[model samples]
Target: MSYLPDRVPLHGPKFAADPHAAYAELRRMGPVGRVELSPGAPAYLVTDYRAALDLLHDTDTWSKDTRPWQQNQPADSPLVPMLGWRPNALFNDGKAHERYRSVITDSYALIEPHQLRRQVSKVANQLIGEFAAAGEADLIGQYARRLPLLLFHAQFGADDQEGPRLEADMAGMLDSQPDKAIQANINFANYITELIRSKRLQRGQDLTSWFMDHPAALTPDELADQIVLTMLAGNEPTANLIGNALSRMLSNPAYYSSLSSGALTAHDAINDVLRNEPPMANYSAHVPRHAVHFHGTWIRPHELVLVSYHAANTEPGPTADEKTAGGDDGAHLAWAAGPHSCPVKKPATLIATVAIEQLTRRLHDLELGVPRNELRWRPGGFHRALAQLPARFTPIAPDPDGVSPWTSSSPYSSTRQDKTWSPKPPACATSGPLYG
Candidate 1:
């Protein structure tokens, strides 16, 4: 494949600071263009909507497994950790992919949507109650990141304390720091391994037990892989989804008021965020089955090809503005498409919506603590997430019964010190909370 001159780099502060501008620059070259993923790992980015759909749907020409490409690279290659082969559905194709995907979708279906919403609301309020007395909090660190983990932990039959540990380690793994990610991967695996062993001896009604007793009857290693996949898949993207939507709500008063005043809905705000700033921004990584020329770019067999969900959604054209509103079928690629598209999008959306509504209603005066421009986002080739979202609100009494309902019975529970009851920070002028 002929290397494109001045390939766009998808790392560092410049790209992380303003990725939309970078996408605009890449769109000028063409739909698909050569780009450097890291120092030496180069891949083709699909920045056009139509081309992205083509690539995702044409799985015969593109495979999800990365071993074909990794086979020739040195053992210490950087790409190995991020895109290395796994036995789970995310890294398989054809019959194997179908088998793994069935287990996930089926297990997830066991939980009702309303149940999921209730659980999310319960978790959301409990989290809010923790910092309600403090008057100040980093929403991303304290609330957004923890909510999904807590909910997932309950489902996994793990205790609440594991949530924070999983949240921190997963954050490190997702960010582009290789050393931290390597250690995190190992630590995360060990944690899941123990969870699996515990479940094997004493199963419960949780998703973990459901998977173990399922018809497929996954082995221990397979169960751990599936659990780790679900945790990693569910954690970062959901955290980012909640964080990004909150950022949009707090930053744009007009938009925030519209949603709160019944002029718009949380669903609308979520769709807008999904279109403009997708959680998994540059993901759905695949490798071509063989050397193929696509959109004037000669991509070799087994070369990394990433579909730019953010870029494709924002690609300038006649229909670029379609994503600003909801009810548009075939509008955004945020949930992706094809056989490998996210199956849990509905639940994910519900969690984000319920979270936003619960936080706004409970606090009633939440507003950004720092200037919008001062917010920092971690740099990476895949996810688009906020590093933190500090905010201020009226201080209220902390919930006396703030402990998670699932904490008491789970074998994985931990007795971490309670800090949510800390004293409130000094008061400041606060914007009146908006309600619909």
Candidate 2:
């Protein structure tokens, strides 16, 4: 009898092209699997939610600064020279990363809850209103893409002219073309270095100025480095969350009606969307400590380990269902695990919640103007999102005095599935109160 071929399934570009299905298959393969990494670094894949969570935050065991798959370029040398390069906090580990987080926390999380909520609500409504009026628009390129950039611009006090250029540069950085990311990274770094210097000369009352004041604690160069990382790390996730969440609303016709019927809160919908498809499919670190006992394999040090955030979010358990219980599954490792999990978790969540709620309450029907299958999604970025999401919808008309309650009755059918954002308020300029 001829020997049978191994039935093992292979996942890589073939599966990464559309990772959800592959994730399901990987989930079935126990909590862990092995895969070859760039430069042939031996690596283990963590698909199990439980194990992945422990593996991520066990800082003692796993580290963010694991040895590079190939070799570590001198810290003085440029790590990303293509678009631009800035070390920021992600490039290091231990106390250094901690200090970086503290600075961001004060601005993002230290604000009083009342003020944060008010500001988020205001920004959400103002942005949604402009897009709602347009009747149809691309959610990713128009609203989802613009909102975070504006917020960051205001937060950092970067020039209004910078948003469009920065977004374009970010897109280029994600290109699959050889050396594109590197080129984009380098260019971006150089630009940020100069921007930081200018901000220092005439300090303004914004996040950038805050950094200028804290150079003793974080140095001007380090802050310049952080400027790039913070922008990249935050914007991409927001875009995906918006696009991915909108995808859910379109898929589940009942979702809009449920929300319009006052059965679900905006927060509830966001939780579901994140669980369904977070912006990032996965997060990787070089296993800085080197050789780790992965699945009983001695695997020598310097091996790469890939943690599947997408799988971890979908982990089947009550823990992941905290959305129902009114708590974010602290168990979901999408932000990574432990105290070191995504530093801006609180603010990112707030912004996402506010944007979704504002839009959900103001619109009636949301129909995709373009074929869903034809939509393009960008890959190879730190996060994943649509290159564009073409859509159309009708906004609820505002009341006589203008401000309508978030739960106002829409003349349009409760079941709309459109993705849009514009600079004008929606036909309906109603008050979009917070829900769930």
Candidate 3:
């Protein structure tokens, strides 16, 4: 495989600052272009919508197993921790993929949508209560990043106290630093190992126990892999989805008011993010099973190919008006496509939608503390994430009865007898200077 001398590097502040520009440049190279994930790691990025769909659906030509390509990568490469072959459904094909995927699909199936929404609401309220009195908070740190971890802990039967440690480890693993990423992977593995061990000794009505009890009969190691895969895949992306959707809605006042007024829904914001700024932007790694010319680029057997969900979804084509007139929202590839598409999209969507709704309802006057353009995007190749989402709101005091705002009948209370979930515009000005 002849390498392109001018491969675009996907890491560092430049790409993060303006990834759309990078995608636009890559489009000039045709549907697919050469790009470096890290300094020395080169891979082909599919920047066209049709090409990405073709690659994702062509299981016959492309394979998910990464072992062959992994052999050539440096042991300490930051990409190794993320792209290296694991025994989970993500790195397998055909029957093996089905076997591993079934465990996840079946386990998630046990979590009903209503039950998951209630759990998300509970976690969201707790997170909100922590910062409700402060008047200012980093939503990323205080809420978006932590809510999914707590929810996953509850589902996996891990103690709530363990959430912080897991969050730290997961962050380290995704940070794109070789040493920290590698060490975090080890720590995360140990954490899962212990969780599985405890579950064996005392099974509970949790995801871990369900995986163990499933008729598929995953071995202890297999169970650990699935758990790690599920947690890593579910937590980070969901967190980013929530943050990105919040950022979009908060940045645009008209959209925010429409959301609050129930004229526009959280689902609309989420779908907009999915199309414009997907959380897991450039991922869904696939390698050709044999030498093949894909979209005019010659790919060798076992060479890495990644689908740029961001680029593909935003590829130049019909305008939103044109798409709407045609009754097409121009479906996005944010959840990926084909057989290996996100297994838990429904629950993930519920988590993000409820998270945004809960925050908006409780702190109805919330506004970004920093200008929208000044917000920092975390630098990484695979994830489209914000480093911080600082925001300010009018501080709400605890109820006279000393009950938390989440359950209190205070003016800012979120608790209501109506079980139905709907957006209600706050009884305050929606537009104002971000911070006084």
Model 1, residue 27: distance off in Å is: 1.9
lDDT of 1 at 53: 82
Could you list the CA RMSD of all candidates, in the order they appear? 9.6, 8.2, 8.2
Candidate 3 lDDT, 62-96, residue by residue in tens = 99998878999876666776899998999999998
lDDT of 1 by residue, 1-436 (tens): 6444677888777889999877876876798877777777777899988888888889889999988777877777766766888988899999888767767776666666766767777778678767877889999999998899888987787766677777677767765677888888787887787778788788765777767766666777777778878877888899999999988888887655544454556677798889889999998889898899888788888688899998988777737555433322368889888888886787788889999887776666678999989999987778899999999976766434556422333332223324322111212112221110
The whole-model lDDT of each prediction reads 0.77, 0.59, 0.82
Candidate 1 worst ten-residue window by lDDT: 427-436
Tens-digit lDDT string for candidate 2 (143-228): 78777766776567677677666666676676657477667767777667766777867766566766555523677667776676
Candidate 1 accuracy as TM-score = 0.86
Sort by lDDT, best first: what order?
Answer: 3, 1, 2
lDDT for 236 in candidate 2 is 75
Clash count for candidate 3 is 0
Distance (Å) between predicted and true CA of 228, model 2? 1.8
Model 2 bad stretches (over 4 Å): 1-17, 24-30, 36-42, 68-87, 110-133, 178-183, 258-262, 286-290, 316-328, 370-376, 381-384, 395-436
